[model samples]
Target: MPQATFQVDQEIYREKISTAIIRHNYPFMFVEHEGIRDLHSFLNPTVKPITRNTAKSDVLKLYKRERDKLKHVIESIPSRICLTSDLWSSIATDGYLALTAHYVDENWILQKKILSFHHMPPPHSGPILVEKRHLSLTDTLFCGGEFFHVRCGAHILNLIVQAGLKVIDEAVNKIRESVKYVRVSEGRKIKFAECIAQLSLSCSKKVCQDVPTRWNYTYLMIDGALMYRRAFDQLQLIDVHFKTCPSDDEWVKVENIAKFLKPFYDITTLFSGFHYPTANLYFHGVWKIQMLIKEEIRNSCDAISSMAKQMKEKFDKYWECYSVVLSFAIILDPRYKLQFVEFCFKKLYPATYVDRVKFIRDKLYMLFEEYMCLSSISTSNQSSVACASGGDNIGDEMDEFDIYESQHYGLTRNKSQLDLFLEEQKFDRKQDLDILTYWKANKLRYLELALMARDILSIPITTVASESAFSIGSQILNKYRSSIVPKNAEALLCTRDWLYEKGNIKFSNEDEEDEELAEDFESIITTLKNSSNDSHSSFS
Candidate 1:
């Protein structure tokens, strides 16, 4: 065949090559047959010139389109949503915001979706406002859904520590000293780290002195330090700041710190025992202050009228109890105590000062009077009603592995013990909605929607909704493609998967209606069973 080959025209050869290339899905273009490697080298020699986008520009366009597609898909989702947000600061101090949306499905089942997760420019002023703005954008983009401030559960540990410090000044001081010691001296830190490493079976030197919000990371460092306390003490002797005898007033500081931290230990214990437990919701820490508020109200209710009459007599008492006055002052002023407790309390109780005072007095008095009667009752005399009564008992359900299992504070709750708590505490689930109404009235509906949203989204606060675009963006906007003018990330995120079928994402508005449907379905199934049973009996 080669010997018989005749000289073929270049045009004919190119034509044959083009046909073959089209039919065979070959990579090469016909222009390469003659070794012509022009800018149009990718196309066949016969292929006409057409206005075309560069690979980088094409990808940038697609990326932008995909983002819009996703945003559309999310916005079309009809329901209330809750968000979990966390700020990430990389080693470069680059700020990244991770926000997740949670919602419920049409069947009223919980769903979570990563709504947005990516870096936002660091806020120059108030970071919270930036967070608020981001949240507002999510709501605006996704529609008028509510947002429940589910601040990271891990943050509660620090709060618990703060609360624990209030009652246990010595322990708080010791912890503060420990924190300060590590921070103040490189020598002390090295010694402490060495000591802790020796004592801990699983200690990491790298974890020392990390921020508290890093949570488990910070805990690891402290746990290690505690494990090797003897070695740590040898490495660095803790000087006695006071010259007082070790057995006398010095011990009281230790006692006070312990007292402050006792409630925190209780919270820790409860969390450690949870089944679906998240560490450090700080519920108990918050509850302690709530209880304290109740206590103060009870103590202060000598009636303003009666107090005026006894004002002169109480002068000595005032001097003795100046700490109480200072505590009250701190509580009233938002500037003191890091602004957390007061801020949270105000948010929880959303009423004005006068209104809050009146509310606390009325609500606490009613709860106290009711609880007093129940507290006086014997376990044998108690009923399930007793277990489900008090508002305070509502918080008890937060204990891990308790209700689901047979445990209370990690121990088996014998029927007697269960009955005792049930009688004494009387926690009713239905009443929860009512109780929350007092605190959550301004925000209950909104919060409920947020809970529903979180349920339906089927994702966690850690979900990466927006970051999904980041890799694609980077791929298109590489150094080689930096000339590409890409669309904004938000627009891209908004419209991804817009036309796709999203099954049952819109949750049913009426929970009662769904319940009714379920009941009807069960009834139909029961009727069918009954009919079949009758037929079987007749045959028999």
Candidate 2:
């Protein structure tokens, strides 16, 4: 009977372990909550509930186990992996850096895995960041040196939109102040809602204050306020104290600004994807942005044309020379190879069109030659290994004779793999075409070139994946759990991501909803306080 009891207790402990992992529940959940502890006691009063410290240890053990498995998987991959990284600061002002690895697995599926999420000491310089991250300076891992560092495409778009926004700062400020007035007090919100009812306006979204740091918040505030424009106009008349209300001309300016920023907003959303290969899709979007800016420059409105000119200046600063890796990615897309790049560059850079295309072609050919040499070396090594293992004396004799004949006759193929691939017809199916599948299907035919394509296409165009790790980190290190040390924090965040990726658990939607709600409320309160201070200063 004692032995039977011991077996039952062991099963109970195993169940507790499984419960913690499957639910992603906090370590303290088991001991802090009376109901959970009571339930465990009822099952086996002799067995004590694990303490939070013990639970943390269990979590660390689990993380190490999963990390080892992941490391093994990463090591097994033949293609070079591309990485994206970003630095984030927590609520406590502790700096953390997240690094994410992107690669295509053997089955032609794109995989994104977070390699690290650790605290970085102060002074986050570029050299220090790379060194602390333990990434090699001269390897493919660092993209053959830092110049090849692919800045987050979404982040770049944000910078461009923010610069353009300076053109309509006064107009945006007015709209922001108006939204702040309505959102600041319950009484003002009720009054606005009443005005909406009176005006019979079909406003589904409430007035949301913008967070100055996030460009999307500005877009949302503008889009939402525009929906209740009529109600806001009515509120201006009813509430005599509503001094921040935007006038008709200001509203028109806001509408134009929203229209201008819509494309940028869409591009950010497009490039922030995690599951699919984005490098191939980047060239088209970037080219579209360039065209959009050019079109806006020719607009009849002075404000818009001026904004476009400033944006064009900023665009030229960043995209003066498109990164060669991006260009190579586009060239590999069979659908839009060298020809498409040549055409786009000629149109985008009419003055330096010849130089730009020549540079791209030259770089591409150089990369092709490098891949061919690597492939030849790999093939020769494999041949040597096979000959050694099989003890193929006859094959060795044949190889010697063949080499002598080749050297004497100078035999050569008419065209290389790169040439053959370039000569092939571009993929006819443009709609819903899978780039990975295309490469995988033709990998055997253009062996070396396909390997290069697989590596290049696996690279993510944005560091949003790393940014997303910070999002998960925020949830893990919430207010109540602020006491979690960086070590434990890393363990929890990395384990959570690993489990979620493996389909062992799902993150709660409520957590995300709560986070967004908190951000929105914080922005509203902060904006209200700033506006109130400004009003007081003006009156004084």
Q: Model 2, residue 102: displacement in angstroms?
A: 1.3
lDDT tens readout by residue for model 1, 461-491: 2223223234333333335544333233222
Runs of candidate 1 with Cα error greater than 4 angstroms are 1-78, 84-99, 105-160, 163-223, 233-540
Candidate 1: 10-residue stretch with minimal lDDT:
320-329
lDDT of 2 at 243: 84
Any runs in candidate 2 off by more than 4 Å, and if so which? 1-32, 43-47, 130-147, 204-206, 274-277, 382-413, 428-430, 501-540
| Alpha-carbon lDDT, every model | 0.36, 0.75
| lDDT (tens digit, per residue) of candidate 2 on 1-540 | 122254346545844664464346455455647888777667666766666666777777777888999899899997878877788888877889987888888788888888888888888766654452344533544224533566667777888878887887887887888887877777786677667766666645656667777787788789888888887799889888988778888888788888988888887777874345458878878888999999999988777888889888888888766777877888888877878888898888889888888887777777777788787887998888887887778788988988987788765444777777777788763667788899999999889889888888887887766677777777777777776788878877787777675411223553454344322323444455587799999999
Candidate with top lDDT is 2
